[model samples]
Target: MARLCLPDGAVRGIDIQGAQTGTVTSYTAGRDGTVTVDNPQHERALRQYGAFPANLGGRSTRGGYRCGVCGFAAYIKTCSRCGGTCEKES
Candidate 1:
């Protein structure tokens, strides 16, 4: 069981509350530095990493994203969505 961080919001960034146990349902990360957790309980821990609910409808930048803003290299090849844009995080 891994812990997930769920931060409501802040200036510096999100934070981790605690941990949980569950199989990862789904994940989404784009070129942006963020990660979304589909696991219900892990929501709190996910925030610590800097993930937030995106306007993309429960979508957030999946792991392995390359953030040009932060010079972060994305490991995952952009996700596929209907409008060509990754539906994970806008």
Candidate 2:
């Protein structure tokens, strides 16, 4: 007899946004309507984990933006890649 096992989590999507993707910048994740490329070891990490949303626009502020390891909650300056501002803008 053969047995089957399924992963509790699955990669959702992969999107290549921004002007120039030469060096990736600004990575974040949230519960709803949030986008992120989870895989760290792989270079082509455009996949996501959360369920895709219907009204991505209306979910403003309801969700949050955080670094791979909960960015805003902690004090993290200068993005790892381009050394940019990770703090939220007013």
TM-score of each: 0.25, 0.19
lDDT of 1 by residue, 3-87 (tens): 2332335333443443443333343443353455545555644544555444322233344443334333333444322122221
- Give lDDT per model, in order: 0.39, 0.34
In angstroms, give how far residue 44 of model 1 lies from its true place. 1.4
Find the number of clashing residue pairs for candidate 1: 17
| Residue 16 accuracy (lDDT) in model 2 | 39
Runs in model 1 lying further than 4 Å from the true structure? 1-36, 56-90
Query: Number of clashes in model 2?
Result: 1
lDDT of 2 by residue, 1-86 (tens): 11111112433323334445455344333344244434342223333323332222323323333234333322345455444455
lDDT of model number 1: 0.39
* Cα error, candidate 2, residue 44 (Å): 3.7
